[model samples]
Every structure is written in structure tokens, then in C-alpha cells.
Target: MPTQVIQAQPSTNAFSGFIQFWKDVKAVAQPYWYPNDSGDRAFSDVIRSWGMLFLLVLLIIALVSANLFNSFITRYLLDIIIEEKNPSKFSDTLVLFGLALVLVTLLSGFSKLLRKKIALDWYQWLNNKILSKYLNSRAYYKINFQSNIDNPDQRLSQEIEPIASNALSLSANLLEKILEMAGFLIILWSISQSVALILVTYTVIGNLIAVFLTQELNKINREELEAKADYTYCLTHLRTHAESVAFFRGEKQESNIIDRRFSNLIKNAKRKIDWEKNNEIFNRGYQAVIQIFPYIVFGPLQIKGEIDFGEISQASICCYFFANALGDLINEFGNSGRFSSYVERLSEFSDALKSVTKQPENVSTIKTVEENHLAFESVTLQTPNYEQVIVENLSLSVQPGEGLLIVGPSGRGKSSLLRAIAGLWNAGTGRLVRPPLEEVLFLPQRPYIILGTLREQLLYPNTNRQITDAELKDFLQQVNLQNLLSRVDGFDTEVPWENILSVGEQQRLAFARLLVTRPSFTILDEATSALDLKNEGSLYQQLQETKTTFISVGHRESLFDYHQWVLELSQDSSWQLVTVQDYRNKNTSITKTTGNTQLKIDSFLKDKFQTKLENSIGEGLSHKEMNALTSYSLSTIRSKASKGESITTNDGFIYRYNKDPKVLKWVMD
Candidate 1:
């Protein structure tokens, strides 16, 4: 069977980056709210952890009520002592009230400590839940590339801590206020009916004002969040690419751009800060006026013989509770606005992520097609920025063990075609029958190398695949990279793979990976562009020996000879699969791998290397000899050299020796 090529029409990706991120957060949070779910379980675990505080609330309430009763007795005894001169009774009453005060103070202190302890644990639980989701879902990648979720690191690390702490404290405070209002409102109503009416009016008016204030605060907060994200993004971007700027000598240019971004952020942030400062000023004044309100309303009534001492004391407690509850309204309302904005942002982000792929109604199981054979019928592909087709479906066939090269001017969707085949670019309509995705390897122009040891670089995506340490070293030698093997400890050694390897070295590493994994087919999209001609030709020649089906996208003319056929993308929105009859003529003497002149080939390569440095021994090694050295079977030459042993091939190629001229020539060269 032959490989088929189809020209595809592009489709736009409509998913909003911000909306998708919110969806992911909700998908993570919703199940936690479920009673038996892990999230719910974690929340429940919080209750147990704070059980002491929960119990203390009951004790605190009892102590407070008892202390309020003692206040009534103390007030009555003082009145009797002043009016009737009953000194002994007043003294005993004073002693009893003092005892009640001591006990109440002790319990209140203990409960406050317990509350603090519980609050810390709740904060930790919420933090863990949010951070876990960010780390696990490859959400970091989605946030960076697919979503407009600006500065997720800031969102997770800084924004989350405040959200969690404030949410828990506000919830607990609200519950306590509700209990106080319920218990005391009834007592105040009985003692001073007129005052109760006034209290209710004040409560209603205060809450309305607080609600209005909070709505305005939300507008300010939303702007603040956006500005903060922008500032954080600039800082993070600056730090991440600091090394790049330093290496390129472009620090001033980068610094100026960052300064502009920061200035914009600061301009917006000042507005938020001014709004917050004004609101807080008003809130503090309102809170101060509310503090002494209890004494003002009920004191005159008690003096005029309107109510008994017990009734007066009860009215005072109720008035205080009512006034404080009104004050609480402002704080809770402000917090609710902040929380709502966060939720809305989260919800919108989720919506976008869910729409990443038009939920496949029935995803057909993908199968790996046989070598050099691809079948795509009615294929179309699209990108977000363009309405035109990236590629439109048409057909061509390629036989097994054959190479098909794609060449075109830039932005022709040559690389995109490979991505679509890999299932990374899903914004397309097509029946793309490919070999099992795992059976093929796609190497991009700049391959991503994760931070890890050399072995890790080689065994990527198949980390658990059984590969020996010795096998890894041999692979490195085949790519003429034996020097790196010593610096690396093992496959598990952690290092920044991208920084340690040069662009060309990284491509060679990718090729080294090809030899180890041995996929049935390989796609190279400017994979060798970073390498010089010699290394590039060497990589292609190595690919030839494996008889692996090759689909390449490059403008390099040297690559044309390796393939039996070439697929040229045309400006007319079509492709040409032309057979090259003159392929043999294009082949250079150096590239011809096997011939009767094997020894002659070695001498020729030796001569080529001599021209670079006259003092160098065996400077030019023939391409065939180089190929023989890189092949898997003769990899022992590298291991032998590392072990300080003299070794040579029977075909007159001495790999590691100092004494013999031929051996010294191979070693020094």
C-alpha cells in the first residue's frame, strides 16, 4: 500500500482562552462540593480538624449570656445602694458579678485561640485543592498557549491565598452575627418597643448602603485584578526570557518594553487603590459611630423609669448586637463582590476549555496504517487567525520505505499538515487515517527538550520503556556526542535539557532518539535546518539505513536526493508529487555509503578533515567510515575508548589507539 497525501481546507479554532481556563477550574471545584466526593471529603475533614473551635462557639455563647445576666444584677444593686443605702447587698452583688466576669474572660480567650488554629487548616486545604488542579491537568500548557488566562501563576499563588483566607473568615463571622441577631432581637423588642422599630430601620438602611457600596467596589476590584494580571505577566515574561536578552545583547530593548507594560498596569492600579482608600475611610467612620450607639439609645429610657434594670440591660445588649451586625454587612458585601468576580472569571474560563474540541460525538478509534501508507479522504484544516484553508483534501500515494519531501515558500501550512496528522491541530474536518500515533515520530523545527538528564532527553514520552544505561551511551556515540555521556550521571539525572544542548545538538539528539525508538515512519519539518550540511547529510543517510518511511518539509536542496518522490506545495492551493528520475545524479561521492572502495572512502574523508588544520592527524575521514562508526553494531568503539582499550575494525579502521599511525590518526582526528 502507498501513502496518501491530501490538501486540506483550514478551519478556525473558536475557543476563547479565558473561558476555557474557568471551565477547568470549575470542573475541578464542582465535584468537591458534592457530599461524598474527595472535595467534599476534604471540606469535611476541615470540620473535624476544627472540631474544638466548633464546640467552643457553644461555650462562648453560654458564657456571654451568663455575663449579660450578671450585668443586670450589678446595675440593680448599685441603684439600690445609691437610693436606699443598702451597702451589704450591693457588696455581695458586686462580688458575684466579678466571679462571672473572670470565668467569661477565660473561656473567650480559649475559644479565640481555637478559632485561629482552625482557620489555618481550612486555608491549607483550599490552597492544596487549587494548586493540585493547576499542576495536574497540563492546565499550565493550556493557560500558556490556548487560553487568555493571564498570569495563572499569580492567580494560583497570590490570588488564591487571599481568596481562601477571606472566604473562611467571612463565612464564620457571618454565622456568628446571625446567631447574635436572632437571640438578642427578641429581648430588645420586649423591653423597648419604640427603640426596636428604630433599630430595625437603621439595620435595613445600613445594609442597603453596604450593598450599594459593595457593587461599586466590585467594579473597582475587577479592574484591579486585570491590572494586576498585566503587571504580573510583564514581570514573569521578563524573568523567563532574561537569559535570552542577555545572550543577544538586547537588554535595553526588552527593559523598555517591560517598562511600558508596567506603566499601563500602574495607571489602572492607582484607580483601584484610590477607590479602596475612600471606601475604607467611610467604613472606618461608620464603624466608629456604630460602637457607642447602644448607650445612646437605651440609657435615657432606663433613667426615666421606663424599664427595670434587667429590661434596660437586655435592650443595651440587643442594640449593640444590631449595630454590630449592620457594620458586618459592609465587610461581607465587599467580600462577596470580590468572590463573585473570581467565580465569573473561573466560569468563563471553563466554558472556553470545554469547547477546545467540538465534543466528538463518537470518536473513531485511530489505527496505525502500514508503512509509507496514509489515507485521508475529504480532509480540511483551519487556524484561528485565518479564514482560508490551510490545506484542502486531494490525494497522492507513496510506497513503503519511500521518502516524500514537501517544499514551499514560508507560511504554506507545511508544518501544520504534520500537526494535523499528529492530532495536535484538531480544528479540521477530515477522515485522516494514520498509522497509530505512537508508531510515528514528528520532529519539529525546534523540538522541546524538557529539563532532564541526557538519557531522559532520549527516552522522552516513553520514560517507563525499559532501556539500559549502556544502550543510552551507545546511542549518544552514534550521533558523535560521546563527550556529553560523561557529564550526565544517568537517565534519571535532572538537568535543563534545552539550555545544555545547542540547537543543532538538540536536533541530533532527536535523531539519536529516532534510532532508539525506531518508529515505523518519521516526519521531519525543518528538523535538520539547525545543523550544517555535513551533519544534515549524515542524519538523512542514517534515516536511509532504517528504511523508515520519511515525510520531510524543508527548502534545503541537499534533502532532495534522499527521497524517491517530492511533494511540492503550489501557490494555487494544490500540491505536486513529482518523481525524481535524476535522483542518482544529485547524490554526491561522499554520500554514497556502500561500494567496493570502502577503504578508498575512508582515505577521502581523512583528506577532507586535513584541510581544516595541518597539524591534525587523519583530518579527513571518509563519509562511509563515519557512517560505519555511527552505526549501532560498531558503537562498542565509543565504549571501548571510554574504558581505555585499543580497538579496531577488520576493514582497516582503527578507532582508539595512540601508537599505530592509522590508530592515532583515527583518535586525534
Candidate 2:
């Protein structure tokens, strides 16, 4: 898959952007709050959620009202100080203010707690809902073909909680601030109408500017999200392919890739910080200027004996609060931009999943039928996209207790046929008759070692099937993993099985699963590739004893002894099925016996290099001769020599002794 550095553009129309953001919020929120038939949603859960929200709103109202009461109390205390100047009345008024303060604090705390509780519940439900859809109908597997959807794991693990939490925070903040604004504005109106009207004009202008700034912020937040995902995916890719990178000594190249990704992330972060710097200046400046408006309006009135200092102070306090509320709204508008980005991303992910879950109506797909055995009837297979035909009208079947080995040159669609049997691909014209998937087990080239305890590893895909530890050890011993228990504590010990087990050991352990499962039909795609002849033979012998019909994709000549039929595919989308003995006789080039071990046709090509490159008289081999005899192409040979693997003379020759090349394989004892 190609790497995608997706950048989102700012919405051109600010009003339309807000309208879309609101619709997106409803789309995201509906699944959780309004009960849907999905397993993740419940009517009872919805009711409980609404009840919590209802209580939260009541607390917010109480807190807002108490704050309004406190502002009025501050005005009353000021009037007593500047006008009455009675110490006993002032002390009593202070007690009332203190009581109101305690009530507001209590309301504020509970309101916050309830908001968090609701968001926490929302996070769990949304995560579960998305996860179910992601895993359903093999959407997780099919989604990989989509390059547009990047870093799904990052989206699932990191992006989900923020959606839940931020939604609540943005909504509650907007609600509380709006209510406070209305109350303070009412206070301003009662004290002085002119000042309140001027403040309202200032608020409208501030909001217009906020909408434009926030739209820009929305673009930045989206870019930042993708940048972070890209950088995270880069690190994860390095970790997954660490062994391959180490073998190639690709640290410099890998580091360059990581640095590039990280730099992109840093660039987005810096851009956001810059936008925030400008946004803060606007927000603070708007509030700072509002601080003097009330004093300016009423200062001349006090000189004319129309009002006292207490009235001026009260009007100023109300004006300050009203502007502060508007300032908070501007900040929330910025956060709403980030909120918009989250909602947009998750909506895209969910829509993609729903789409891929359904089959394409217009496209022709191979029909599947579940039967007692395996067979392909007049099957013409194509790639998933129907880009190329793999085989034309191919027909074959395996008997109830027989083995069929698929052999072909590399890239001849051998494994692609197994995929058809597994029902992973079906974009073609044919009828694929096979046993129920539950009764068929597929072992790929690299066996999947699931994360679990030693016992769980052995009994994967059916861990609930009870089996004695002693019997499991017997199965392990059958696969030549007898000392595995000694290395670990026992069957219950859980380690990183993939890291701890060698490729050969992991393959053996995969075969050990066959013994445990004993499925009626089995498909092996180079399942024993990592195992030596001894272990391969032992496992194949065990498989034969199970009396299960199996189809294997293997190039080994020795594998012919284990199977009755050979299915050979050609690069030109042609195939021929014949008896194993006849196949061996007809294609002598494919099967070569090297001592007791059989070398694959490609390996036989490499084995000849031992004799061909032999420096019998201590004479160097020319580049042409080395390139002709070795498995690697001339381009590959030149690349390796250029990288200091070999020192060649100006004449393009490498000197060596006996049958050994100048470069020797380093074996760690």
C-alpha cells in the first residue's frame, strides 16, 4: 500500500461549515444517545444516558444562577461600602456572599463530574460499536485494499476517547457561558441601556472574526491528526519490519523515513501553535477593551450627580462578565474546529466500513456451496478487482481421504486458489464446492502465532476445547517441541510466542494445531517452508495419520510422496493435474534429489553454483561467469559488491579458494 499524507482544506463558507459540523455531531451522537438495533446500543442504556445528561443540565443551570446571584451580591456589598458605610450591615452582607460562593462551588463540581461520567460511557459504547463493524464481514481484512483510510489502528486506539470527552466539554462550556452571557447582559440593560447596546455590537463583530479564525483552525487540526497518525504508523512499521531492516543494515534509510514523518508532525504542531498565538491575542484583546466601556459611559454621569460610585462599579462588573462570556465562546469556537475534525474522521471510517461490508452488486463473483468435500466446478478465477484472469474453466476435486499437492513456478496463482477455497476472494465465474469453513483449516507460509499462554498457543482458534496439559505436551513432543516447557514455566506461562519461537519452531507449532484440530479438510500453502526435512516429514506423517483430505502448495519433490495428485500451474494462466508419479517423470527439471534431501527447482539452480564457481586452481571468476552461475541477477551481484560485500578487481573478477565464494556466510554458534 502507498503512504498517504492527507491534508484537509478549510471550509470556504463559515456558516455552512458550522451547519455541517452540527449535522456531523448529530450523526456521531445519534448512535449512542438514540437507541439503535445494533448490539452495541440498548434502549435502557439510552434512557440512563439521557437521565445523566438531564441531571448535568440542571447542575449547570444551578451553577449559572448561583454565579448571577454572586455578581449581584458583590454589587450590594459595594453599595453598602460606598453609600451606607455601616460596618454591621456590611459584615452581614459578606456572610450572604460567602454562602452563595459555597453553593456555586458545589454545583460546579457535580456538574463537571456528571459531564465526565457521560463522556466515559460514550467512549466505551462508540469504541465497541466501531470495533464490531471493523471486525464484521472481514472489513478489517478488506479495508487494507483502501489506501484512503490510513492508520485505522491509531484511529481506534487514540482518536475515540477525545470525541466523547470533547463533545461534552464543548457543549457544556457553550451552554454555561451562553447562560451567563444572557444574565450579565440583563444586568447591563437594567443599569444602563447605551452601554449594553455597544457591548452587543462588539460581541457580534468578535463572533464574525471567531468564525473565520476557527474555520482555519479546523483545517490545521485535521492536518495535525493525519500527521500524528503518519508518524505513529512509521514507528509501528519500523518495529514490525525490524528484522528485515537489520539484515539489510537499512538504519540510515529507516532513520530518514522516520525523521521525515516526525518533521511533518512537528510542522503541523508548529502551525497550530502559531494559529493559537494569534487567536489568544484576539480573545484577550477583545476582553481587555471591554473592561473600560462601563466606566467610560458612567464617569461623566457621576460628575453630573446622576449616579454614585456604587452604580458605576456595578455596571462595570456586569460589562466585564458579559465580555468574558463572549471571550469564552470565541475560544470554544476554536475547539469546535478540532471537534469538527474528529467527527469528520470517525464518520469517514464508519461509512467506509459499511460500504466494504456489502458486496458489489454489479460485479460478478464466484458462487460458493458448502458440501461434504472440496471441488471446483468449471471455475474461472480472477483477481479481486478482475484485473487479471488467474485460471480459465479449471476443474478439480480431492477425494475424502486423499492428498493433492499444488506445484508451480513462483507467481503462478497457487496460493490464490487456496484463497478461493477459503472464500477470501470470489471475483470470478465459477462454483466453489467445499466443506464448511469450520471444518477446514488453512496453514499459510508463515503460521499465525496468536498472543497467549503456552497452552493457549497450542489450542488457538478453539481455546475453549478442554484438553489435558499432559496430552498437550504429547502433541508438543510430536512436533519436536519437547523442551519448550522447560524453557518456559509450563503450559500456563504466557510469553511473546512469536519472538521466542524460531520460524522452524513456529511452523512446527502450527502443525501441532493440525493434530489438535483434526479438521476434515486442510489447505497448506508452503506451511512447512521453514522446517527442515526431518521435522517436515515427521509433521506430514502425523497429518497422514489423521486421515484428513488435504491440499498443499509446495515445491518439494519429497512432498510428492505424501500426496497422490500434483496440480501444476503455469505463468500463462494454464494448469495441468496429474498423478504425482507421472508429474515427477514428465518434469524431471522440477524434482532433483541432492543426497537424501530434495532441492526445489530454484534451489537446484543455486546448488550448481557450488561447482560452477569453484576456484580449483585459485584463479578468480569473471563477473560474467559469476552472474551466469549464481542465483542472483547481475544487477543484484553488482549491488552487493558495491555495498562492500565483495572486492572485485578492475577486470570485474572475484578471487576465491576451492568451492567457497570470497564472501562467507557468518554462522552464530
What are the per-residue Cα lDDT tens digits for candidate 1 across 1-669?
111112122225435534543454455444433345554566656457646555756765765576556556655765666565687877787788788788878766766666666656545655666555555544444444444565566565555555444544566567666666666676677666777788878767766776787777677666767777777887788777878878999888877877887787787778778878977897677655554565676567668876455555556656666677656855676676456455544444444334332333433222324334665555666552235566666456556688988877788888877866776654556566667777888888898686666666788767677888788888887877778866666567887777678899889999888888888888999998898766776678889899888799987766765788876666656775667533323333334444755434466655654452343244533324434443312233333333345434333344443444554333532
Q: How would you encode candidate 2's per-residue C-alpha lDDT over 14-55 as one tens digit per residue?
A: 898778777777778987887565664777888899999999
RMSD of each: 11.1, 10.1
Best by TM-score: 2
Model 2: residues >4 Å from true position, as ranges? 1-24, 36-40, 146-148, 203-286, 299-310, 589-669
lDDT minimum window of 10 residues, candidate 2: 660-669
User: Residue 5 of candidate 1: its Cα lDDT?
Assistant: 17
The TM-score of predicted model 1 comes to 0.62
Clashes of each: 40, 0
Candidate 2: clashing pairs of residues: none
lDDT of 2 at 475: 95
What would the TM-scores of all predictions be?
0.62, 0.79
